[model samples]
Target chain A: MHAYANPARFLRIARWLMPALLAGGIVFAGGALAWGLFYAPAERLQGETVRIIYLHVPSAWLGMLGWGGIAAASFAEIVWRHPLAGVAARAIAVPGAVFTAICLATGSLWGRPAWGTWWVWDGRLTSMLVLLLLYAGYIALAAAAAASGANRRVAAVFGLVGAVNIPIIHYSVIWWNTLHQPPSLSLSGSSMAPGFMWPLLGSTLGFTLLFGAVVLMRMRMLLAGAQADSRLRRKALSAGEAA
Target chain B: MLKPKHQRMVLLAAALTALLAAVLIAAWALRHQASYFYVPSEIKAHPPEADRSVRLGGMVRRGSVHNEADGVTVDFIVSDGRADVPVRFAGIRPALFVEGSGVVAEGHMVQGRFEADNLLAKHDEKYVPREMAGMTAEQARQTVAQTK
Candidate 1:
């Protein structure tokens, strides 16, 4: 972990990993989309509209997963002050926000045909909304801190504090009455048939890979921007000293 | 007072505004396709104009269910216990949709009957998914007896 904490080494590894992960994500996502859309049986009730679940469920999973990634990265930044951890955390914010938006949008779409409402103020929906708001707030705070040259440690602390929402988001459905259905898949046992289960697993893996690729690419761009900014600042300081 | 950093912040604000605009427009465009729910009494009193898709929800009347010749399409009565409405849906019924059970039917009102394109079983506090909260003691016993 300490060896990988070096930004140069992390960048080197991510450079190769990003392309492979992106390619694999595209292939897997395409296959899952095809299987879910055409090959999988139409929900005996919902017909074609049920195919939306393939996209909706995966995006929702990634939204939560992206937040978990950010929290873990933030922890590393705060605890060990790992050089690249802050970058990892910062890089995830945009994609996390996008996934949260997708989750809410697609969930609303699914709800219309499935639940007969575009939105419900149910426990599950409310908690997911809170998750989106938290993501937005984190991004805003981090950006403010970055632009002001405020301490990154302070931003990392904020990240850690805000992460308390994760478990609440996870357990909200269980804790309160909700219109959303409970998770169909469980670690203890399989509730879904193999046809449904395999595609879901594939889609989840694809989504995870896609998240990693996007984060790595963003991190690269951020590192480059930071390096250029620091170089310009140093040159300006030297000129001021000479003057 | 507007420094380079302040200008960057303004740019971020503009980007956020654009993002919000895109999201709102997308939501609005899809609003008609979104789902709407109604109780059986509501459907009975104000049946939506023909061909407008909607959902009808209520308890399944005790003995009004009948298996159709096609076997897939079933005719049943949904009641608030005060007012009853007939529903015809050609699809697999949800596992929990039975007599005395709360149910939601999705489709449109056609002719005199509520023609459901989809069926969902709504559970009460007493009934939750087995995987999450597990079955109640009564349900557990019933399952055990069925296995034997």
Candidate 2:
């Protein structure tokens, strides 16, 4: 991890890796979506509405994974002061929020048919909404810190503090009697049939790859911006000396 | 005194522990509020005040669903394997609303019958292909009965 703290080295690796991930993501996500949408049979209860699970589950997973990444990056930023840690955390915020929003939207769509409502204030739904809000707050706080030249640690600390909500979101169904169903997949096994589970897994992997590609793309852009800012500062310093 | 690096780690650890503790305490306090609905067993064990509106959630009792003469009102019993609450709702039910499934109704008790103003269906976690779920109605009823 420390070895890649050097920006140039990180950029060199990411250049090739980004496109590779993007291509793999497209292939897998496309194939999985095709399979899920057309090939997989309708669920016993939910019928065609269950097809939404292919998109919904992956977005929900990635949304949570994004925050988890931010929290880990925040930890590194605070403790080790890894130079790229802040960049990684900042890069994750927007995509994470996007995925969270997607999760909520797809969930609302699924609920309208299967659960008979577009939205409910159940434990699962509410906690996920809170996660989205946390993502928004993190993005805004990070931006404000950047603009004001304030300590980035403030945003980093917020990232770490907000991580407590992750567990709450995970356990909300078990902890409370909710309108939302409990997890279909767990460490023990899946409640879903092979016809559904395989494509769902494929879709999850595809989306995860896509998420990684997007985050890397954002990190590279942020790093380039930082480099430009520093170069401008240096040029100004030299011109002032000459004057 | 610890080195700055160690100091930061210790501080982060302490801060995280404190945050987790605070959240745990808050969740413990808000457990009842956090739960979206109460089961029939809970209602039977400790009924709420007459005027307070609360959500009641449980399985729709098999063979208990009845359509009233008014055509809008429907009567059913919600069961949680331990207790049962008879509910009456006068509204359009959802597409998934059926006997032997799960439902959540929001209203208050009036003369031992729950008068529900809103209803939302709940679903189970199982997701088998429709072809594989060609169980006879008797089999479906038995499954619900056994689960209940």
Predicted model with the maximum TM-score: 2
- The DockQ assigned to candidate 1 is 0.04
Q: In model 2, what is the error at residue A214, expressed in angstroms?
A: 0.4
- lDDT score, residue B62, model 1? 85
Off by over 4 Å in 2: B136-148
Quote the lDDT for A222 in model 2: 93
lDDT (C-alpha) at residue B25 in model 1 = 67
TM-score per model over all chains: 0.66, 0.94
Docking quality level of the chain pair in candidate 2? medium
What TM-score describes the B chain of model 1?
0.61
Task: Name the best candidate (by DockQ).
Answer: 2
- Candidates in order have lDDT scores of 0.73, 0.92
Q: Cα-based RMSD of the predictions, in order?
A: 11.3, 3.8
Chain A TM-score of model 2 comes to 0.98
